[model samples]
Target chain A: MRDRINALARLVPVWAVWLGYGWVAPWLIYRGATGGLGAEPIKALERELGEIALQLLIIGLCLTPLRRYLGVNLLRFRRAIGLLAFSYVCLHLAVWLFLDVQDAGRIWADIVKRPYVTVGMVAFVLMIPLALTSNDRAVRWLGARWRRLHRLTYAVAVLGVVHFIWLSKGFQIEPLAYLAVIFALLALRLPDSKSLERRTR
Target chain B: MANRWKNDLRARDVTPEAVYLDRRQVIAGAAGLGLVGTGRAARAKVPEPNAWEDITSYNNYYEFGTDKGDPARHAHRLTVQPWSLRIDGLVDRPGDYDFADIMARMTIEERIYRFRCVEAWSMVVPWNGFELADLLDMAGVQAGAKYVAFETVLRPEEMPGVRYPVLDWPYVEGLRLDEALHPLTIMATGIYGRDIPNQNGAPLRLVVPWKYGFKSIKSVVRITLTDTEPPTSWNKANPREYGFYSNVNPEVDHPRWSQATERRIGGGLFARREPTLMFNGYADEVAGLYAGMDLKTYF
Candidate 1:
């Protein structure tokens, strides 16, 4: 079954996956323009894009655990997943900046004054380095340093979830659920004492 | 039907059907002139009432759900017929007043007032209803009454959002006796010459124009005249975020978002947010009510 899964994963191109996922933003924009996104289309579109970006980040986080525990070696597509998440995050920020909040001074004020926006901006800023280094040349040049830099993803994911939770009015379950899943994924990555001792020996 | 007040805003002042239909063009024209965030000088003109679709579809009634569209989707289950408002506490005539009976006694009129939400979004609504003061007079407000408390209908089977504790169930709101008695305050029964849709607080709802939208509680079921301050749903949920005196003050921002500017609903995709007015542009009418009081601390 594992071999079959690996073969199936190889059959699909990473660029195809990228293109498929990339189509969502334009589709949402189309929906917004056509009045399909309901009364508050700008807010709806902004939230949907943010949610999609978070979901993509969650998917990217799952790759390591899936490969380690279940022998689902989909490591080849990790770069594509990371870059897609980054792209979606940029799109989400763009929508918020251009459509939802059109004022330049207010945008800067929000980032500085609002804690949720600050956290969201921090997460977006962190993703920039990871996205820039996703290329093969950067990976080869950075060597061991590349993996260390990419570990920033965990912090970015946690901050993203925190931002969502903080931004939501009242106590909402959806953002809390994201918080739980991200924590569990991070927990799975923790090195067991025995494994650590063995590796040191 | 009218005793004293005159309509300041007319039906023609409502957003034109042509403008509403061709909002994209208007938005583009506005954007080209860099008019999106020009500040308070540009906001002097009276706000145009949003289209019927925008007013009905976009709402913050959490009884149906938290999402803006949730009320429109789930409010169909709400049964507004055979409704009665329980008017109790410091009143001479206190009983389960039937909805139709109340309507017959009160004089309803069109009150085109600016509606601002605490979330920094706004609309101009032409509410058809009578002054709440008139209703209080009929009930015979006792001298001891200091506050007017309101409660929304709580039908778990009907209101799906009630299943979750988004707010204290049976959403409650309150106003100071003077604030409640203010001529600007009305119990709206209809919108734009039609009975309000179930999603937009059907049958009867308090419409306190100068305060935030949530202060004008929807789908009201009870109104209690009391001496002590009453607990409001949002204030109870998060006092830091929401206050008992949730007046629309542009200077006093909500903890989460800015209240200085508001996005006008139905302004199309690229529309700029206009600066919010003090007391939602009704300060001239209602400002004297809060004389010498600290709005920032109260907010």
Candidate 2:
């Protein structure tokens, strides 16, 4: 019971950051639109969301690393972080689909014609299955395949990075840092499990 | 593929590969592409003129203001009339074109273009303008003029963004000689039928469709032809993300994300995102300009 409480405690901040990001974005947009914020409120919102999504995903990915390095072993917090990351991304997408385009045909033309949207769409689409299987029942039902399927998160990480990199138009310092973290995490996965254990020790 | 219907009905599969590979009939496939969420909700009537006034006013030029919509609202006080464009630098006809003279010399055509910001969201705006090439020709770009640079009016009184050096003041943007000449590039005077709103780069602006939206410079007070490449505001702010061409190409992803596809605004629930095209579908017309150059490198 004490261990469970500790794990839940570890997840609280991550959830706050995740949920807080969504709640703040529209307010920012409203502020921007109402002359409370600077010139491009919508752009600001889009940027802020993109950034938070990447950061949270990185934080969620870091759970395993945190356990190994700090000996924190907050394994229970993992699902909550993953779910929160998914929630934030869903909100990020909802804002784009509803607020910006407002036209059916033109919006259709853009998704069909534009590439960044394609990669982002693919990333979003792949995420749905992962989210669907996130619960314990779905994981149990799928059994071993669940691990294989959830491996899509790796792709999600890659797509998320690509989505971010392309959105910036130029190299941005923040996304590069996320990429480095992902790279280091992924590089650790390449060597044998014992190798990581040895290094951590 | 057994899932022909699924593949057939997928949005953004307009690429030649999908067109040829999917065994679906062409006409039905085309209709499916267009008709997603057709009867769901009553389509909102296109905003009437000045309908966007409230929204357009708060534009973010970064150099003008950090707020996205700040430029439009703040720029309302800018003196647009009595404006004369200084056509100097590498132009043979290096002189001024009074606002009236420039307006009288050109014919206005309305073109509806999809504007995709590098940020991923997009808007479709109907812009009224004259071909930019016509004006460039009148300016008589000298032989050495390989680039065109534009300068926006900078005043701290109206635009507080000018106070802090987010970018060099009197924001500048540029284009290679040919990209400037592309027919898709325009000197915009009006949008949605009225004068270009102050927030939307009123009085006059440049619209480069193939490129990201910022390539479309707004509220132009000066146009300078240069032999060397001009420093664009976003490019100067972050060179890797905002390139000189800054054209909408899916393959050359921005450093933050892939440009492989974009979400068109107004999509309904379950509406799939569309794939972004190379050269924003102007390859046949403008592809020759880039010829053998490496897009990945230039990008």
* Tens digit of per-residue lDDT, candidate 2, span B1-299: 01111211122212233432342244235557885244323222221111233226434466456555556547667778878888899877889899789889887776656577776645555678888888988888788888888988776786766676556677788989888887777888986566887778778999876778778888888988888898888888787667787878888877655577665433322233467767765576678888998888887
TM-scores for all candidates: the values are 0.93, 0.56
Q: Model-by-model lDDT, in order?
A: 0.88, 0.68
Please give the lDDT score for candidate 1. Answer: 0.88
Best by DockQ: 1
Q: Tell me the docking grade of candidate 1.
A: medium
Model 1 spans > 4 angstroms off:
B1-3, B15-44
- Candidate with top TM-score is 1
Per-model chain B TM-scores are: 0.90, 0.78
Each candidate's DockQ: 0.64, 0.07
Residues B156-212 of candidate 1 have per-residue lDDT tens digits of 999888787777788999999999988889999998788999999988999998899
